[model samples]
Target: MKVCYLISAVSSDNTGRGGHYESLKILAESIYENGLDVEIVSLGDIFPPTFGNTSVKVRFIQFKKSDSLIQYIKKVADEIYDISPNVIHSFDNKSYFFARLANVKIKCKLVLTKPGGPNPKLFFPRCNDLIVFSQENFAFFKSRSRYKDVNVHYLPNRAKKILCDDLRIREIKELYDISGKVILRIARICDSYKESFIQLINLVNGLNDQGFSCTAVIIGFIQDQHVYDEIIALDCKYLRVVTEERYTKNASALIDLCDYFLGTGRGVFEAALLNKLVFTTISSSRYPVIIDEDNIDELQHNNFSPRSILKNRTEASSKEFLSSVIQILSDEIKLNEKRKYILSVAKQRFDISSVMDSYMEIYLNCFPFKRNLIFDIILNSLVVLKVYALLKLSKNKKAKA
Candidate 1:
């Protein structure tokens, strides 16, 4: 079985580092381990130019973003024709559209992993399979009249378990000079999650003022210059901001250095796996509290969607939420066993290895077959030229206008 991924560049201020690229790399490797072939067609210009480093041997095609939409679609289709992959999986809508066009004659299984939003536009009828991270998203898809027969899978995201020795964890702590209660919140310096970096600083400041010796470790890549500047301006002594390049690369190590997690989405799961008390500010029934057995299912089914959870509860302020966080952290001694229970659930559910079988089954059932290579090459070349001409004509029209 051969699968080709049509993904865009990881350069957007929002949703770029939301594990779209990282998860693809992990999934591709897992697929390869099951004795299938995998390839990638990365769209746009990925800055820092240092993504997708993996051991899985697959052909990597860099699709330049400078081209017009017609040109871009043509290039994708041409690559699909040349590769003749049995399955074309896309991570976003634009790529899915182009992949559908590319597979017009090819008739391959098209899969779409929905983008970061509640109401993602599901337009391609050719998409045989759809993957969503939450029940809410699944419900949204089901409500769409166009996809009554489409197969939509509500598969929650998974993460590799973080492994570190006690010595290593201690070293990380010492590097940051973290001696007191360590609180970690991992997110990009963006406004997508209704998260305020300024608010976090205030929370840390509040904790210190209340005679609690604690350090707030804010670790994430800086996507917005304005937000980054605002965070830096505060310079709260208790807040240690680690705005390093590719901070997600070192997320596990950083998670190990914290006593509590004060974030949403994947970071909360990672902290739970590491046996730390986790409190999410995201939308869910258990918002602003430690994730326990009683509320794990709701959060899990909801995919820990931060922004959505916060939207309904407009009355919930960060200052009010911080008080609950303070109360939880202050009573850490009494909640030690609850912390262990949270880790147990996280390990059982969120580990990538545990969930690989479902993915493997999906790939295996895609019904792989070969297409006429000679005819595809001939047709694709003609289509490419046609698109190029249309692109030129469009440009001319725009210039004349």
Candidate 2:
């Protein structure tokens, strides 16, 4: 069966960055490998660097970010009409709404890949299936009355082993003149993940005070300008900021250059595959946990917290966290042993082929619809009319005032 994938933005550039784009790339590759027809549509620029001469049809449709819902529906509906896919899948709320609007006209099964915690407000009754990145998210969604019968599956975020070399790592290190220990953190710098970023800053500053040479390489798309500004204001010599597009093409190689890895979510999975020392701060967790074989399963199943943001971690916890990091960095033999175990776990669980198998099962199970054209038309028309009426009422009130 043919499938069309829709996302708000493919990447900071066409090649792509971030978990959503990476996840989409893997799933699309699986679809292609299985000999299924797949098409990708992005609201923003779409020439993904990762797709790299693949057969998937990737299209970019330009639209104003401020466009109204009706405008968005029309634009996405036009594209969906052309693709005529059996199933339309989306990755975010806006795209999910776009898929629903398009489905009204074409009767395609709508699937949402929920990468974070459940948002009841974004729930749509017409969605056929949902794939979540963590068990916590799956259970949360499953418990919702609105999603009582919806097919919700817990699929831990997966990352295929990435090839990287020490030579390339050194080249990057030399390029930046990072002479001391290289600590890397890849995440979207924003308020929601304030604890991680703040902790990274504090950890680096604290280490430097103890005469330890260390540099924190912060990478990822900047989601909030204020947060970005705060990071810049730190003016910590050990801090080096890099954009998502700069190293995403060879992300593993970049991670290889690091003496230690930080951040949470999919990057943690990638780091483990690369056998880097992974210490992460999740929203749900009180402090950073260094990933090891014993806790990897629980960490993978729970993933990162979606909504909670620690205002600030406690001083005692901060001191304990710093001690753990220093201890790890000081022990070369123990670090190597941990690396071997982490790599083995990654191979066993995060293989893309297995991830693809689960995805394929979901796709095959969702049958194509024999749509009631009249009912769809009536329902969608009523929705549009209700919105229009509300707008008109507000305009009349403004005019009278």
Candidate 3:
């Protein structure tokens, strides 16, 4: 069986935090082990030099963001035409949207997962199955994930266990000499939306003043060196920003090393998977402050989204948000109370052992025939399309009359 992953860029060069890479890493390893052919195709979004170091087999298709919707759709279809896989699993909105629009003529299965914030507008008319991370997210669009119409799987997003041997982790621990009650924000500096970085800074600073004495480690690709330099230039010595590369190895290690894990974008999912204590901030534009790329990325998902317009994420009461942050970090019992549920939920919903079984079941259902009966069905289906076309002509005439 040939299965392909359509995701954001998978450049062997990048060694940073990316949902596409992490999930696919686990999948490819499992699928390849099962003796199935696997390939991952990049959708040409994101900064260059993605982690190509993984064992997951990969390829890239140069898709431009500037292209018109029609052009983009055609290009997506064209790319799939060339890949010719029996099953395609697409990640995030753009890949998922365009893959459905491409809708190439093939007896293949299509499965999609929401990579970040759930944007309901991106849903296509038809796909074999859907996977969503949050039940709250699925509830917002219950019609789309009804389990009967589509094999909607409430498979919570999961990362393969971080290798623990990453070089950057070693580097961060040695370089920072990090110790005692550390809070972490490890996400892409260029995610589709943006914000919460500076509030996160202020929030952390506020907690420190409350006698919590916690340090925050910020990690992601600083696309601009001057901006990065300016962030480090801040008077708040507790807030530290590191390169995208170090964020994964070093920062994720720091998350493993730290007392509390702060959620920004999908990074919360990572921390949750690792059994770290995590908190996702309520969006509060109510307490206005300077929001930058990293913050905005977390808030807006940084501009890679098909629909980045998000007021719900940014418009939260910062003071209340700050209070919650302090309470969770300062109160051990309260923190663990939340952690017990999250860890329990993660193991139950995102566990990897049964994923391969799920995929195989979906494939068989979407394209049911493995023999020449499929050919007979196709011949009959073609005749049905022809008969439908003729019936459409008759219906149009009757309407005109």
- The Cα local distance difference test for each model comes to 0.64, 0.68, 0.56
Better of 2 and 3 by lDDT: 2
The parts of candidate 1 lying over 4 Å away from their true place are 10-16, 47-50, 58-60, 65-68, 121-126, 164-177, 194-199, 246-253, 283-287, 308-333, 366-401
Tell me which of candidates 2 and 3 scores higher on TM-score: 2
* Clash number by candidate, in order: 1, 4, 31
Off by over 4 Å in 2: 10-17, 44-55, 64-72, 117-126, 163-172, 210-212, 244-253, 283-287, 306-321, 369-401
Regions of model 3 farther than 4 Å from truth:
8-17, 33-35, 45-51, 62-84, 92-106, 122-125, 144-151, 165-167, 173-177, 190-194, 223-234, 244-254, 264-266, 285-341, 367-401
By the TM-score metric, which is better: model 1 or model 2? 2
Error of 2 at 69 (Å): 5.8
Q: Across residues 1-401, which tens digit of lDDT does each residue of candidate 3 receive?
A: 78778765423223234655566666666777777888877664342244355566777665442454356546767878777788878764445544544444654767777644554553233344766655545554455443335556665555444544445656765687665677776666553323445545776687776666877777776644555555666668777666645454334444675566656434554566677776445443322222222234333332122233345444445556567556765677877776776666545545565576876776556642223233433443343334334444545576789
Local lDDT at 228 for model 3: 57
lDDT of 2 at 393: 57
Best by lDDT: 2
Cα deviation of 232, candidate 3, in Å: 5.3
Query: What TM-score would every model get versus the actual structure?
Result: 0.77, 0.78, 0.64
Model 3's TM-score against the true structure: 0.64
